[model samples]
Target: MAAREYGQYCGLTQALELVGERWALLIVRDLLVGPRRYGELAAGLPRIPTNILAARLKELQAAGIIRRAPRSRIVIYELTPYGHELEPVVLALGAWGFKAMGDPRDEQIITPDSMTMALRTAFRPEVAVTLPATAYGARFGPAELVVRVDGSTLDVTRGDGPVDVAFAAGPDIRRIISGELAPDRAIATGVVEVLRGRGELLDRFASTFHLAA
Candidate 1:
């Protein structure tokens, strides 16, 4: 085989070389939530130019990180099982970014997607709480999510329903987990609300899983 022009490197370096560009990680982050059409991805990432987005998607697909699926005469981008595995890595990076750069209140705006990622990242397998089957709702930006917490994991779907716990946060989930806001006070000020279910369970859930120093 002929020598490669990009130079030879180990797996990690090669992986980074494919995705090290700015906005590339964010592209992966958007796909983490769910499959999206080209327009949807482009809409979500306003900072990314159309041609660049197209090229990056092509690169990722070529590298086997994402796959293209045809739906309704349009192509949608979805992460492969291998690509799905990167969710934790992306979440960890997000958490690290939050910690290294102190919270800026003015800049703290939680979105539904962010909330879902935060929930997954903050989840503690050790803290097992049996959630009621009751439905719950939370609103972030133009999106409303129905959250169902079962055992150690949580399931969140789009739309509103009668949720056991209805909570809203003005700050990013990382800041909330980092103790910037007293969880109790959040409830008091209506920043967080537990509409149903055992309120004590919510408190215990917070204590057991919140990301502490």
Candidate 2:
């Protein structure tokens, strides 16, 4: 089936033509953190049907928003240079929509990419500036991500690496980030676990990043 186009010359309309389809922007969101193979993308977006995922990938590729490349000798889908330029647009949209979020229910799923991207969305350079250089790790369910802070630079990357502090968190990470639960209390309540390093690292993390209320 042909993609539905807006048939307009407006920049916003044109952009939507390329990415406004269902699951299209979410695919972009998944890749924003980094490249991913087909399986990884599928796993991250469990609700998307397999055929729809494949079609979206093709659409994104045809629009030059994403491209296929080799990572570790395996083909992966990554954003093109033009596609990477959508970072600000995506972040802005996320920030704007954040206020609407309340809480998740028992059936709702929060993907790893969503959490990691939220880390980027909530990064506070002002807070990072006061901190000593360190890397913090959070393992929530099967997903592992690391946050590296140096001076005012904070980077969150997928997968576990050498980190100064590691936290094994439950779905309560959102609660922790939202300040509804203090890290220590979450740990004490068995909702979060300090897998490695000082338990205080959680406090430092809470202070360093914010959800913008």
Candidate 3:
């Protein structure tokens, strides 16, 4: 079946013609964190039907939005060079909608990729440039993320590695990032833990991000 068309010549309409499909932007969002295997993408978005996922993948590929490559003998979906340019667009969209996100419902699943993406949206380059460079370990229950902070940049990746600080991140961390909770109070409540020596970095890190307000 042919996809629907806006029948308009505007650039926005044309761009939307490629990514306006349901779940398309989300597939792009998941890939923004990094490449993902089909199974991993499926796991991240369990609600998307298998048939729909396949169709979206094919559509994205044709639109030059994403490409598949083999690594370690397994194929993974990754963004093309042109597709990588969508980062700012996605980040801006996330920030624009951030202030409206009060809380998640019980059934809403917040995947690790989504959380990392939130970090990307909240990152303040001016604030981060003032902090020291270090790799910190972030564990949310069983999932772990390597969050590295460098001059004017913050990168979040999925893995376990040598880190200067390690901690179990919870709502308190989110509250701190959202500026709803103070760093001292978060620590006092035992919601944010400092497993390493550089505990001060956590405070600096928390200060570097906030919901778009």
Q: By TM-score, who's the top model here?
A: 3
Collision pairs in model 2: none
Question: Given candidate 1, what's the lDDT at residue 152?
Answer: 62
TM-score of each: 0.79, 0.87, 0.88
Model 3 pairs whose backbones collide? none
Candidate achieving the largest lDDT:
2
Off by over 4 Å in 1: 1-8, 105-109, 129-136, 189-205
Q: Rate the local accuracy (lDDT) of all candidates.
A: 0.67, 0.84, 0.82
Tell me how many residue pairs clash in candidate 2.
Answer: 0
Order of models, best lDDT first: 2, 3, 1
Q: What is the C-alpha RMSD of each candidate to the true structure, in Å?
A: 3.9, 2.3, 2.3
- The residue-by-residue lDDT of candidate 2 on 106-155, one tens digit each, is 77766779877787887778988888888988888777888898878878
Of candidate 2, the 10-residue stretch with the lowest lDDT total is: 1-10
What's model 2's lDDT at 171?
62
Better by TM-score, candidate 3 or 1:
3
